[model samples]
Target: MSTIKRDKGLDNTLKVMKEGYLYTTNQRNRLGADNIFETRGLGGKRVLVLSGKKAAETFYDNDKIERKGTLPKRVVNTLFGKGAIHTTTGKKHIDRKALFMSLMTEGNLKHLRELTRNHWYMNTHRMEQMDQINIYRESIILLTKVGTKWAGVQAPEEKIEEIATDMDIMIDSFRGLGTAFKGYRSSVKARRRVEDWLEDQIIQTRKGKIFPPEGTALYEFAHWEDYLGNPMDSRLCAIDLMNTFRPLIAINRFVSFGLLAMHEFPVSREKINNEDDYAYMFSQEVRRFYPFVPFLPAKAKTDFHFDGHKVDKDTMLLLDIYGTMHREDVFENPNEFRPERFLDWDGSPFDLIPQGGGDYYTNHRCAGEWMTVIIMEETMKYFAGRITYDVPEQDLRVDLNSIPGYVKSGFVIENVKENLDRR
Candidate 1:
């Protein structure tokens, strides 16, 4: 194995912040390394950033790395609440993951799709009354309602906006230093508020004071047992429950990107129809072409070698999710927004992971990935066929430097109208 090239810097955190999603890809190219390179990041810790199919395979190998202790405390508290499934390992992680996987069944997915579609339709009436709508902001509110209802959470109608704002704050807090710190503090309070609410529901469910219907995520997770077969903690149950719904709201970013694509590539909109397959392809392309998570971090479980590079035990490794998706070696003219690329493409987990790569059941891949795709497909179809709206003149440029990117004007739409031709 060849020695890994080291980035000579006391800390590259500023560079990462400045470059955002392009940090790893730019570093690898600048160094002319194969796929792996080392750098010092945040707090001057040794960090290895890697991309491409082989590197992703190595990063996802459970025996070589672990999720625990990899993420920053700020991220843990803000983005993923404490004791979330994102922080677990081994059998504990597997058991907790199973709880989420159980809810992703085909029937449940269809139910979620219907709920999201119905909620979108319900919201469009209000949009028609307005001259313009911010799809990003509107999607967060709409999906929050869809998510809460689908999860069987009995949130009052008045609380929906509050819940959506909290979730958005949590996601936005993942970046920025002092601002992020404040957001983290607020997120902690917000998380506590949400947990307290869910804990009460869990307690009520246990005591039969209230009962969520069977097969709903809230009911199943409330009654879930850990690997030890003990009743799960109410706080952890709430964290997991929030994990389900928060990501559903986060899908708003992709929905925004999908709409932007429709505006930029008007021809692609014609491809999406009532048949979900076309929408699925368009959604896949949106995920690939747009930015979501820049990268995922993990800690080396033991000393290991990959593609002529050595990774020390406990070294922080970043799998470049954004870079991997945009790699020219894998995607032809990747920067272009093309939905048909997925129509005949072979399905490889590593090549197109806007979420995370590998088997969702075994690894740290986002459990809600299927739900995200389903929501995006339904969203695309709704915009393309079920509803009529005009994209108003606005700045639609997405700043690549922004982590969790969004359109500059949030993809504004004017003259929102329902398609009388449909239904």
Candidate 2:
């Protein structure tokens, strides 16, 4: 076995900050490595960055890597609450994941899609009275309603904006250092308020003061038992609930990108409208073409060799999610926004992981990934066939350097109207 090649410096933290999603793949190209390389980041911690399908398979192997103690404290506290499923391992992870997966039944997915469709219609109807609409902003509000309703959380009609802003802060905190601290503080405060509210709701449900519908996420999580066969703590249950709630809202990013794709590629709109399979293809293309999560982090479970390179125990491993999805070896014409590429997709877990890869039930893939696809497909179909909106002058450029990047102008649309032809 050979020693892994390292990017020598005090740390490559500055490089990572500057390059963002391109960091690891840039290193691989610069070093002339076939797949894996090492670099230091964030407080001079040694990180092994991996790319490509086989590398993803190795990175996600539960026996080789674990998630607990891997993420930054700021990320854990803000983006994923402390003690979240993102920070569990072994049987604890498996059992908690089961609780989450239980809520993703086909019936539940259909319910979520219906809620999203209704909420989207209501929001667009209101937007028709206005001069312009920011799809990014409107998506947050619309999906927040869908998420809260689907999860059976009860926020007052007046408090929806506040709750939505809080979730946005949690997601926004994961970016640059200058704003991250401030964002983190805002996230902490928001999480506290939300968790407190959820804890009270769980308690009320248990005490019969309020009853979330049976089989709803809020209800199931409230009453879920942990691996030890004891009722999960109310606070932890609240975090798990937010795990479901927040990601659904985060699909706002994809909604923005999907709408942007329709504006940029007008030809796709016709295909999506006329064919159901094309909608799926369009949604998958949106996910693959856009930048959302930059990378996934884990830690070595023990010293191991990957592709003939030694990786020491407890060393940080960053999987290049963005780069992997765009790898030329895996995607033909990797930079283009082509939807037809997915028409015959083979359903490989290791490839096309805009979200993380591996088995959703056994590994660390996002539990709400299926729901995200469903929501995106519905949004694409709505944009293509059901609604007509004008894409006015706006900065549609996306800053790839920003973590969880958004279109510069938030993808504005004017003269919103229901498609009279479709009606």
Candidate 3:
């Protein structure tokens, strides 16, 4: 329902297109079309995947187009309509994206990259003696802690703990909804809680003069854009940081997924002797195959024709990254895990986007993509090569539910992680 329209109105094709999801030819046609073209996924939708790319382009050029469609106002207030990312056109979308991109510079990302390594250090050492551990719990806390450093906020330790718990609950609400009387509820509760906390902290910061360099992301957001009515709207600023933090640190999940992927393709580990090389190729490949957000839903700013079909204003489109990555047309032997595919025969770099491509327009298109690589690279170096890890055997099922994994016990990389800085 994120981008797949759940509205009462709209035709079948639009609805299906908006859903932007695909299914295997064997399953019942969710669209009722006889020809459910086989896509990169076993349960892949061909039409959805192609439309994903087209919508990104359309939204990128919003001025030339008109975005008049309705969006899920209840979920996301920012980047919702054509004016927002989901429905904007032309220079408007690009300009906003550029503004967001500015926050993620190589210089700024350098600090973030180092921070990622430190986060790993903290989490890895926390369970140095534990035989079996939960990587997700450790990683999520690491992200929250790291995000605070970037935001420049310094709440009490208790406050940080409470806020982190609130955010987790809010995130889980999405998956928890289906079980209650065959209905579902989006978990914005945690978001709201965090917002309230941010409000309190923002007000406190404005009243005081404390802009630390390792400040909270809220400080960055507040100061990034030119001051308008109020020069110190910390709540809005905090929301910006939280929003970006939630998705931006998605690299943490990618780190986990990348480790899991490498576990499958054991030979890939030898390449990690060079951390930089392994980080780039492995993170890129794993992201391409198992993108954190598989399908991206965007709104078209104007009426346009794509792939021989006419799309109306504000039409919802699904970007099928999962299927698209596996497109036989793009990758050679799509299913195989070949990190070398990214490495040119001459070893020159090629364009590979597990994050996204075609103007980089997508809902979960994280701002700190470079940081993702840094974290993954450091993590791989620690476990895959520098430090050996023993991965417990487990079954991996394509968890349609979330970006990470929907398995009973996600992957556990254990071997008493200690002294990672052998370099």
Each model's lDDT comes to: 0.86, 0.86, 0.51
Q: Residue 163 lDDT in model 2?
A: 86
| TM-scores of the candidates in the order shown | 0.96, 0.97, 0.74
Better of 1 and 3 by TM-score: 1
What does candidate 2's lDDT look like per residue over 1-423, in tens digits?
Answer: 677777888777777877878877778888887678888878787788888898889888988988888888888888889999999999989999999999999899999889877777777779899898998988898888889999999988798988888888888888854233555677789888888888889889889889899989989988888868899888888888889879989999999999899888999999998986898899999999899988888989988888878888888898889988888998898999999999888999998898899999989999999999999988888888888889988899999887768998888998989887634
Better of 2 and 3 by lDDT: 2
- Give the lDDT of residue 286 in candidate 1: 92
Which candidate model has the greater lDDT, 1 or 2?
2
Candidate 1 colliding pairs: none
Off by over 4 Å in 3: 1-71, 77-99, 155-162, 172-186, 214-216, 224-233, 344-356, 360-365, 400-407, 419-423
lDDT of 3 at 266: 74
Candidate 3, residue 412: lDDT: 69
Question: Residue 388's C-alpha lDDT in candidate 1?
Answer: 84
Residue-level lDDT of model 1, residues 1-423, one tens digit each, is 677887789988888877888888888888997588888887888888888998889988999988887888888887888889999999988988889999988889999989988888888889999978999999998998999998999989899999888888888877763133555678777777877888888888888889899999889988888767898888788888889888999999999999999888887778786444888999999999898999989989999988876788988998989988888888988887778889788998889898899889899888899899889988898899878888878899999887768888989998988888635
